[model samples]
Target: MSYPKDFLLNLYKTMVRIRNFEIMAEKLFLEGELPGFIHLYIGEEAIATGVIADLRKDDFITSTHRGHGHMIAKGANINRMMAELYGRTTGYCKGKGGSMHIADFSIGVLGANGVVGGGLPIAVGAGLGIKMKKTDQVVVAFFGDGASNTGAFHESLNFASIYKLPVIFVVENNKFASTATTKETTSIENISDRAVGYGIPGITIDGNDVITIYETAKEMIKRAREDGGPSLIEAKTYRIKGHFVGDPELYRDKKEVEEFWLNEPIRKFEKKLVEEKMLNETEKRKIWEDAQKEIEEAVTFAKESPVPNNEDALTDLFVNDSGYDY
Candidate 1:
């Protein structure tokens, strides 16, 4: 899998952007600038950046609660996203959905679900729609290791297999589902092994390696677009933060977490690029500086945006009849 130098550089830039955005979001949340819970994608940047790089703007994706990276990688405007986090009127969900429910239909983002395993069925339905409409577009469903155990996962996979829907199931096996380690909650050694029951191709790879993820996603996405049916990919990675902001995270040892930092995906990829002569120290610094600058601008935009009007609360709500008795 030979990627062009420009392509590789773009990947690096995307990862850096995601990282910086998450870091800024964390700081904002801690400083009480942003409302609600946020699941930071600090250490898991490579998986989203690499996988999304292979997708077309029209290609659909179902995101998880930890979905900011997916949205950014898929080209969602940082200003709107930051505004949403700030609970401002100029947001993706008009200041209502906050961190867990951002969606851009024009770009094929079905939206991120807060429920565990919630997006599975939605992804399957989207694939069915694409097939019925006779389009070449494919859908990618991003879920965590914990979601693979949910009933929705089984039902969606079975339905996709039986109908030969063009969808890719990406399992981000970050070793833990919330606070519980996956090893204690699941019996299978590999989450991808479950794909065998659906008779779809299942392969697990190093989620930290952006090149590996990019190559694997290219093949699976190509297969789906060609009407070759669905495939499951398990990317073994780790979350660098607690499940949500302010979490105590007593489940794991401090030393274990500290050790994992040494193998952080962003640093590893930066080192590889430098060694391969694709990027110099000055170039890498420029990328980091540019990402930080973009994030700062986004934060400013969010802070300056107005809050949603009190009367506008019922505008986007499902039940619009204010007179209805509860």
Candidate 2:
């Protein structure tokens, strides 16, 4: 697939933005500026950026606990996201939902679930909604390798396949489900192999390669929009960090972790772009600087934002007109 120069540059920029955002989040978390446990998407930027690039603004996406990249790639405002992390009132969820629970319905972000496989069924439901409405929009469910083992994953895929629902199950197989490696828990060599049971197309690719991810997602998304049944894409990627902030990471070797960082997707893609003469060093530097500035400004915004009022805790918590008991 031939990629336009501008499109390629934009992809690079998105990856950089995600990388820098996560880096800043990590720094803030360590400095006690941000609250809650954060599962940084430092190494998985390419998967979200590439998959979301093919999605329409109105198309729905269900995200995992490690979902900052997905939200950013889907065009969520970083300023509000930062405020949410800071537990400020100006956040996407009015500071009620932290990093793991951010949602922007205007951009079709269904919400990032804190549960391991929570988003699978939600994605299926959204797909059903789209089908019933007779819309061409599709839903993308972004989950980790650990989520594939959940009953929700199996049940949702089965349901979607039987009904020919327009949903794509994207498995961000980052090798580990928290502290446990997939090799320790999963029996199959490839998570994509499970798709055969559902009678849908399943394929595994280098999740770190943005170009490959973009092309593969484009095909599956196009197929889904054209009334094709659900598909499973297992992205074979690695998480450079521990499961969450402050994790001891004793389960994996330090040497192995260092090696993975050496081949970090963002750096690899930048090298490829420069080699292909699609991006110059000056442009790359400018991109990094711009991303850093944006993140700095977001942090400032979050810091200056007000905390949620104590009496308003239950404001948006309930759907009923009667409201909830305090």
Specify the highest-lDDT model's number: 2
RMSD of candidates 1 onward, in order:
1.6, 1.0
lDDT string for model 1 (1-326, tens) is 26678998999999999999999999988998788999988889999988999999999999989999999999999999999999899999899899999988889899989999999999999999999999999999999999999999999999999999999999999888999999999889899999999999999999999999999999999999999999999999988899998889999998887888888788989888888888998998999999999999999999899998888776654565664335
lDDT of 2 by residue, 1-326 (tens): 26788999999999999999999999999998888999999888999999999999999999989999999999999999999999999999998999999999999999999999999999999999999999999999999999999999999999999999999999999999999999999989899999999999999999999989989999999999999879999998899999998899999999998999887889889889888889898998999999999999999999999998887686886677527764
Off by over 4 Å in 1: 318-326
TM-score of decoy 1: 0.97
**Candidate 2 error regions (>4 Å):** 320-322
- Evaluate model 1: give its lDDT: 0.92
Q: Using TM-score as the measure, which candidate wins?
A: 2
- For each candidate, the alpha-carbon lDDT, in order, equals 0.92, 0.94
